[model samples]
Target: MNPNTTVALPQRGPAEHDRREQIIKAANEHFRHYGYSKTSVAELGKSIGVSSAYIYKFFESKQAIGEAVCAQYLGHIDATLFAIADNGQSATSRLRNVFKSLMKKGLELFFEERKLHDIAAVAAANRWCAATNHRAALYGIIERIIVEGREAGEFERKTPLDEVCMAILSAMTPFSHPLMLEQKTPEELEERVVAITNLVLRSLAC
Candidate 1:
């Protein structure tokens, strides 16, 4: 019976969201350019023209900022895979689209945004077990697609789905590894991804 006892709250508008994104973007650039070890909160804040205390308001620490950047990168991959899966295409077509998008996106992030790629690589290597878990989740998405394709009789393979999934992920390793990606031109790397993907498809197809 206390109608007037309701509390009012402030709404988070687009501007606040945009400012947060800007801070993250600036942090990502700094981490990428200087490597995570060299990047400091004061330097990042200076780059964004905010005080170190203000940076803390957004992210608790540099490690937290790095994790957020990595999450953003993985989010893009998840979105692309889900979009392809939702399309009304054949299973094979969807699978192919996923690989193509993966390769293209990987190349863009590795070559064009080389600094960010390096930062992520260093983080993942140092955090091996956590990185492996993250990778397993990513591969689980791909495995689901394979399972659907197999159920529809679109994919034919004798291997267990988990094995096939590991193979698919193994094929993508070069793209994620900075040393490997560094040794090749973007075109060459793209070709390598396509070749490996084709091999996996051939093994899986009827």
Candidate 2:
């Protein structure tokens, strides 16, 4: 971790933990409503009915608060992947399920928090390589699934497993882009995800 990173020290008591969670939630709402650059500590404190100093007790700075919000968002993605891994499905099926879940969650985030999603999208476009590697751990899980599937003779692709993982991730990127948010129902989005996932699976599956 960077020296500048203010680690969220684990809260000891119930009240303390609740307060910290409340501050983080308030910050997330503020960031979602007004983009990261526009959200102020004072505005966040006012929304949470606390003084700016009190907010600082839980979070060190606006950038720290932004990191917390991003961590929470990515944490959700991690949980979904873990759930799929625990579903007792074959490796191929697990990979498909994970991608579908990810796409569904992306759509939810894109539509429900358009401003925050837009901010993240712009950041990603500007730092595509770093953003891509930032999620390397998650992609590693998919690569392991591909390797397992290949060993089981379930996926016949001769391309390297890492390449296959990248292809799967690439297929899901459209769901996260702002362009996809125009005039699309949840069901339609879900169908599109399912179709794309199936196509990738077909191309790779034995």
Candidate 3:
């Protein structure tokens, strides 16, 4: 799925919205326990005290439910990163904070639970809209930091802004990307986060 693509959702009344939330909540729990690939819409509906047909009214297919759950999960991280980006810190400090916060949250949310991690891994591998959008938002945050740093004379301006942003993101991907986060132990991830964040900062230095 393209990160920038938008799906137009039909407008729902308050009751409809509440019902959809209920379904999503139950699916999240089920997926967390049994994993996305193993769980079925019929099973999720039964758990939520609804019929499989009724569940389909809210979500077109099991993949739609999975996407919704994954989106909700990533929404939390998006909020955390956005807050750090706008916290009025120096660009250097904000950039470092962003990387560290992302790595920490990625591990705590994804790696701590293997089943939930699988959902993320699948979303990433399949290029689900949830994962793509999360990545796009992260790039925006990084670009914003670079712009601020350039304005404050803390980052080099000779390089194109987008190029620098992409370079930093590429360097930090091992720690921030879902599939790569589990490639190392938590202790090892932390060490790499520090090393990569500091190295990126050095490269950005004016």
Candidate 4:
């Protein structure tokens, strides 16, 4: 190297990004094992080999970390629903698939990861940005399906699109909302979800 030639500085961006991800991953595992409400930021830091202050550098508070973890879980469901919406199936079929997938995924979180589900419930109860965004994404998916059905001449266009979408969401609330999922067994939800979805589909038919 020539004397006085400037050496490229090591990039902190990727390392900082990796550190932030590591914090989220560790917090997720901690929350899953111990539950989000019970786990503190100090516990999370200890689990991840970082100080509480350092973790705070990546997240504003324990609730912020919980939001990140909740977002990760909800994001998976959103992606799955989006894929179903875009599939080449008839709009009716895609709409039905979307309802079924939402119920299936909600039940999975409620039953399989009971503890982790608390974070989601909290997010919803507080109208946290993660939960709000997830709901919007779901609504968008439903709207897309509805638009497709109308364009295909399979569904009535008489109903205002917003009204139809809201009606569908309200009908599916018991099966799709995290807190509401607690009211019934998986079997009960399955039976009712099918009935509700079919009812909505019939109402939409041209």
Candidate 5:
């Protein structure tokens, strides 16, 4: 090795792939413990016995790490909703269960991991592409259920599909909204969510 020579770093590959997952996993744990704002790249690197620069080779910034964690979490939630949509249950049953499942998981995510909630909220407000696209896919699930209900004579088709999807989401806000969730009592929240869900369903009935 020449005194002034530096070797070029290897480009990212499968070897780097596992380390990247490790960083994301560690970041998730750190965010849960320390919150997103307080969780530093330096701390994450230290936790994994790497330098902050090395972590950057995997993720560009602290926010990037936070986004990765949020992505993973949201992906699981989406998968849950997607699975519910695919079940053999009636459209009404699927819709009802979607609300039930989302309410249960949303509360857990909001209360149990406040930091993760904040990260997700910011990601949406900032118009992160993944957030928008994932949300669109989620909306498609709801719309499909609505369309199914209409075809089966279980629901009215007066409203446009997009409008119905929007309305459904608005109705779900109480249970699914991440921010401002702490303002309501758990008992009241549950009651309100159930009432609103029923109201939305009834409005669509044939």
Candidate 6:
């Protein structure tokens, strides 16, 4: 064999990719219905008609599967905020949509899919740092909106970017925290979210 020879490694075929997706989908349903911790990798494989070893070929462990499920949950949200950030709307307008979408998603997940919500909560509790990173990725979208506002002369840089990001996340705690906001009526929640959005905009005024 010549040392200088370039080997052409095989790319993953569509069939294998499809199988992997099937596994993740099955894992999510198991987590959403039976709870994440309660679903073993073997159980997941059994449900999919595959062996646990086959499951391992896709995901190393139950924890990995849980993380994948959480990713699936966040994907829709990230796409929503991604669109908001990319739009030509004013920063204030984008911020309103951002918060509105987040609160709506929270209500749907917390009420309609309580077991899935529990899986996310348990994952965060067990892996605090990774969970923080997941939240940070979303917060970074807000930070990008703030930067745009500053550049467009609609907002003042009253504080550092990181501080501003944290402040926005802090202000949105009620909307993001399902337990606290769950008690409020729909009308009450809307009123609170609208009021806070206005307040946040005022603070960012130039």
Q: In terms of lDDT, which candidate is stronger, 3 or 4?
A: 4
lDDT of each: 0.69, 0.67, 0.81, 0.83, 0.76, 0.74
Worst 10 residues of 2 by lDDT: 2-11
Window of ten residues with lowest summed lDDT in model 6: 2-11
lDDT of each residue in 90-120, candidate 1, tens digit only: 7778777777776677678776787777766
> Which has the greatest lDDT?
4
Q: What TM-score does prediction 5 earn?
A: 0.84
The local lDDT score (0 to 100) that residue 78 gets in candidate 1 is 62
lDDT of 4 by residue, 69-178 (tens): 88889999999999999998999999999989999999889889998788889988997767777777777888899999999999999999988987887787787678
Q: Which ten residues in a row have the lowest lDDT in candidate 1?
A: 1-10
Best by TM-score: 4
lDDT of 6 by residue, 1-206 (tens): 22112222122334357767878899888887888778888888888799988877766667766776776676666677789888999998998898888788877877889888776566556643334555665687788899999999988987888777788888876776556556887678889899998999888898
Error of 5 at 59 (Å): 1.8
- When superposed on Cα atoms, how far off is each prediction in RMSD? 9.3, 5.8, 2.7, 10.2, 9.6, 8.1
Worst 10 residues of 3 by lDDT: 3-12
What is the alpha-carbon lDDT for the whole of candidate 1?
0.69
In lDDT terms, how accurate is model 6?
A: 0.74
Taking all chains together, each candidate's TM-score versus the true structure is 0.73, 0.68, 0.90, 0.90, 0.84, 0.81
lDDT tens readout by residue for model 5, 21-105: 8888898898888888888888988988999989878776777676677777877887999899889789999998888888787
Clashing residue pairs in all predictions, respectively, total 0, 0, 0, 0, 0, 0
